[model samples]
Target: MLLFDQNGWDSRTYLGGWTTLGATADAVSPSTGERLGSFAVATAADVETAVDLAVSAQKTWAATSPEEKAAVLRKAAALLEGTTEVLATWLADEAGSAHGKAAFEAGLVASEFHLAAATAMMPYGQLLRTGRPRTSLARRVPVGVVGVISPFNFPAILAARSIAPALALGNAVVLKPDPRTTVAGGLYLAAILEEAGLPPGVLNVVPGGADVGAALVDEPRVPVISFTGSTPAGRAIGARAGELLKRAHLELGGNNALVVLEDADVEAAASAGAWGSFLHQGQICMTTGRHLVHESLYDRYVELLAEKASRLSAGPPASGAPLGPIIDAGQRDKVHSIVTRSVDAGARVLAGGSYDALFYSPTVLADVAPGQAAFEEEIFGPVASVTSFSTTEELVQLVNSSPYGLSLGILAGDAYAAFELADRMRSGIVHINDQTVDDEAQAPFGGVGASGTGVRFGGHEANIEAFTETQWVTIQGSIATYPF
Candidate 1:
């Protein structure tokens, strides 16, 4: 609800709504380190209020039939689809993303809703064919109140990914979004859900920072904690949830690796690598950070990638812009420092060693050695570091040695070669001849190790993980009459 001037001036707003200044930081524009509006920090009392409302509403919500839940979710999807243009514009401005990227993310949010709707109404467990002497059945039931803590990057889509499934299963959600981009996506979502006729308190939005989130997660009324953030943060939340005996679904950070074999198409591999590393300024958890190319083709692929990355222009978030600024100044400086240290450690900056505040040129580095910060950490920025490997064995060993295992992308010609490399990669999801960030609605999208603990996105994975619980209906007659 706030806009800044072109001369890097600031503004303020007192929009009359249920706003919570939970983030505690000013909502500064990435393009111009200028304050757009004051982000109020939500207090523990506010979190208690939100959780109480959700807990009060959950009983009725859980009693509603699955078909009713599906109807509401589907209608919400329709409303979201209708508001793509406005939603994308606001999202781009708030999050500093390209218009096209924002629109695509909005569209995906709508699609996830529809998919979750279908999951809500789908038939439950199947009956096994047993002897006529006994009868047995099973059912999938919904868990009660769920607490959703979403991150700033991909705010809309990621929030939708968790909320839709939780709602579809008839659980009231208390969502504590990252204060930085809460207005970017959550407001439109709440409006659409309201238009879809969801009852009050079923999807409560509590805008706040870490303290608010901590309160919600630790509350006894919140039975499930669904978190998407850094690994350290996730571990902290998980431990607290464990103390309370609450279920936790965590999606953490990653340092993904891209492996290119000698037989791979150099041009195609380079293109895929650049797209995976530069898209969203490499903020995506699945974005490729480490590049392992066979020595035979490493030089050629590096050259191609450098040329391609140098040509990418950084522009405003308006329509037709190829790309936009990073999410914030802190992230920009982190990336800059990592790149600078890598250069000092003998890595050569192949291209893009300059920056304009929030915009770091798409960067590529070569001659990267093991244990360097750029090679060791998850540089979630528009940067990729290339390393050489003498054989597929060496490549696999190097990638597996990292403490993190999220997603890995392997580039090779022969099907067997790709499969072989993928078989040895120590990651949850593996992509062959494709970019690592390419996600499908029906696939189990998540990570392993430092990346995350459970699956996300809209699919059987979400349905089974969100609502379905195993129940055994046993017959004593079966055990007594069974043949010995």
Candidate 2:
């Protein structure tokens, strides 16, 4: 059965099942400015109710057998794989993702579910050595309920990464997806899991604005918070979570760097750079925000990058354009402002620095320096700022200068040299011959500094750590006599 249908958009936000709140908001298509449908607008009270229900359901879910949990997750994965095209269409219509990016995200959601299913079957504890005549072991247990706040970009993947693992590990989740992408990010997952035999209250979707998110973070019932969004918002969540003595897994913003060594092929390097910067209109957190090329090939690299940027046209994803519209006019204006300010600061726009409505042209800026806005800040747009470096030390300095250290990429003829360079870089993820915008379901994905709490998501180990708590238990034949 289809998890989502156009007619199902009404009362899309699922607290336990498809239900409506006191208020509702329209889910508008960013690419066409058409109303897809309305979704429930969850209030602070709604968030509290969702968390309360999750807490009640988590106990029974935690008592379930690992095999049963695994079976449910695997079924969910199969369902997602079967309906990839349907979800991809939602992604394109709701989040303005290009067809290719939308399809990739749809596939990624299924992959995440598959990975979580495997995690459910993995060993949950380890035996410990003890000196006394006692059996001691450490076992993993659920963290009660997890509060997940996900962004619009790669909505399904980001939310599914945290949600699937948490549920597989027997913890219920109360997810708050960005209001702009409620259908794809929130309701879609809820629908699939419910159909796949997920019990009521095990996964809750409450789509709303900032107030709703703050309520989820502040709820005392939620002992863990998994947030993916801007750096500023992450900082606030981290601080509040700390005040509540709760664990927070934050995957925040990034101004990732792509370094082209002197020996690198200029054409290949340019291709990687363009893909990293322009894919999904650079809405990705791991987008290549800065390009640091060696002085020898810098001019040619810039020229090729400019040509690539100029060739890409921004329009609706249905138009078969490689680049899609910005999420809204406000975001388009923010991107254009950064480009204009960078140009004002002496950086030349080599190809594009323009927009029509919400569609922004893929822009390339050359001679971007340390102090320039485009180079220093995380531009969540299809804008590539190129700079030249003469030495390894200079390249390292350039890469580390940014406040964000999410992802780094190095392209060089010598793999050993690239590895050594990666060692010196401060980023959480490094690619030797690839771009910054990349991820795998099995990799430990996160960043340091403003990017996120380091290594908090992905892989079996990280997922277990993020969603479960370790408890030490001792066993004996009977109650032993103890001196009191």
Candidate 3:
């Protein structure tokens, strides 16, 4: 079956099944400045109703056999793989993804479903040793219901990373996707899973603004909240979830670094740096925001990077451009403000410092220092800030200065030296020879410090820990007498 259509585009939010209540909002194409379609805008009451249904559905779903759960997940994966073209189109129009990025994201989402299906058949728990004559064991159980809040940058992969595993492990999910990407992030999954034989109420999609997100977090029925967004918003959700005594898995923002040692090849390093900073318009959490090079090679490195950046053009993904528009005008303005402030702070834009409509050009800034806006802040745009470091101590200090530590990358001629430098880094993920923008369906993905809570979101072990609870049970053949 086809994944999307005109009718599905106009459908309401998925609560148990598709239904509308009250107001609706339009999903506009960020690249084209045209209305894609309208979806039901869920209110606080809709979030409450969705969570209640999830709670009710979790009881039956948790008791389902592992084989049955795996079958459904595998079917979902097959369905996703079959409709990659359609899904990519939705991603391009809604999330402003380039054609290649959109296709890669669709493929990754399908792979996550396959990995989650494998998790269903894996070992759940272990047996424990006991001194007394009794049987003892620890088994995994579902967390009942999970609340997922995904961002627009990576609408498909981010939402599917949590939702697929949560469902495969028998926990129902209530997802609130960003209004900007409601169809690709929220309703598309609902439609695919529904067609793949998933039971009603097992997965609910609500598309709305911050009010809907607050309602999802405040709902007592939701014990787990999985959020992927900005650092400020994550801190607010983490604090509120703590007050409610709930588990909040936050994958927040990052200002990652890419370091080039003196012995490294400036030409090759420049290419890697460009890919890290310009991929997906540099909107990813692990995007390389800071480029640190040895003082001897800084000028040449900056020149090559500027030349590379100038070759890239931004426009609608349908126009086959390498770089696409930012998510919206507000985001485009934020990018421009950061670049402008950095220029005023003595940083020079070597390549691009201009924008037209929603499309911002790939920009390279030189002479950026520790205190500059481009160097310190997480500029979620196609902007690369280049700085020079004199010694190893300065390099260490420069990389660790940022409060956000999501991913780090180092390039050098000597492998041992690069490994030594990587040991001093504080980020959760590190790369020795490659840039920082990377993710795998089976790898543990998250960050430390201001980036997020250390709890990760992928792999077999991490997924089990994130979505399930462990229970200890003991049994005896006969009833024993007890004194009261």
Candidate 4:
């Protein structure tokens, strides 16, 4: 098992001679208290070395033809598909995602890899009509080196989304996988990419903590920093990137709202909302943590939502469990703290509002005050807090009042009603009669305002953002066309 950093030639063939370095994070298995391998807490110097390597390697890699890049990415997709089980196992053990979900997340890595290959085939720049004394053509160039700072919640998929786009665009990448889940998932992936013929140092994965991230983002050679994590952290990173004059793409935290109108199918809405809100213990950025239900349906919806949450079974990720533990003790405490505050502030705990050991049962709270912690904060665990509103105007006001604008979901039988709800909700992505977390690889996924600064995915928009550039190509048909 190659640990920490890999040197390509020797590391790929060697299996068991890996050595651990730096202080290990308290990476407890969320399902059980099993102590997984610790993540190396990389220092500033480690980050500097990784960024330097990426910058050095990117110069040559960017010069390669797009066809060559496509071939390499295609190979990577195939390799990832072949190793799904191994990758899935790592994801389950480290991130506490259920086995089936872990497999799904790992599979997305391959899907995105394929998507990147497709994106590589896309033509860069465009020919414009010009009546010219001189002819000119423009082309986009790589931004050189990119620093990817990923989160622990969905390590494999989030890291792959950012890193794949960077590499596919011909920029070298320095990936800092979330320390919590680095060993079980990302390390395996770094090996696969290396074996799939990605140039040495073209893509490098460095496992580390917060200090390393600061170092990576601050480096002068790292021109772009892409981050997916909490709102506060995203702010800090955006500030640093601004200081360095580096391009920054942030997919930050969310307090997603799911509104169910009186006309909606109650049973369908209940099921979809439950799954959306509670999946991965509600740790996803797009998870619908808050529900603003129509007053007419609020009581019944809360009852059903609470019952569903109570019935959710939590266990080890390998057991084909429906739910697993929160990522770590810190997250577990954060969830608990939110619930405690809600209760103290007079919110009624409907069901399963307590935590034991690594597991916190799917929790549902009702009658929460608008300004309470549960109402205002991003309770990013398997906890659902519902509040009722009487009018469409009230629902819109409540949903838009939040600082977050990541995703908004609505459940309603009337298409027009759903459309109106979507128009009013303050979110970057909106779902109709569905879960907020449902995202297609081809569609752009991101948020606005504090939620994030930009969006990403593999498609025309992604290409424009990741690989395309704009240049005004001007030409003069005659010397008189040029004015002093």
lDDT of 4 at 261: 88
Candidate 1 lDDT, tens digit per residue, 1-484?
Answer: 2221212211211112244443445665676555655544567887777777788888998899888999999998987788788678767777887877788888888888998898887776667667765767776666777888988878988888888888887788887878788666455576677668788888777676788889988888888888988998999998998999988888898888898888899999999999999887788888889999999998899999999898887767763556688787788889999999999999999999778867789999999989888898888888989999996568878899877888888888985778875877888788888767866567787788888875755486565666445676756554464366
Q: TM-score for each prediction? A: 0.90, 0.99, 0.98, 0.91
The backbone clash count of each candidate, in order, is 8, 0, 0, 1
Better of 3 and 4 by lDDT: 3
The TM-score-based order of candidates, best leading, equals 2, 3, 4, 1
For model 1, give the 10-residue run with minimal summed lDDT.
6-15
Clashing pairs in 1: 21-40, 21-41, 21-42, 22-40, 22-41, 22-42, 22-208, 22-209
Please identify model 2 stretches exceeding 4 Å from their true place: none
Error of 3 at 92 (Å): 0.6
* lDDT of candidates 1 onward, in order: 0.79, 0.93, 0.93, 0.79
Pick the winner on TM-score between candidates 1 and 4: 4
Backbone clash tally (model 1): 8
Q: Per-residue lDDT tens digits of candidate 4, residues 1-484?
A: 2422334322221111122445446555767778755545556876676666777788888888889998988998998898888778778887888877788888888888888888777776666666655666665667888888898888888888877767887888887878777755456667777777788778776666788888888889888888899999999999988987888888899999988888988788888889888998898999988888888988899999998998887777766668888887888899999999999999999888887777789988999868998889998899888899998888888998899999888889897768875876678898888878876667888899889985755465574585434555665566654365
Clashing pairs in 2: none
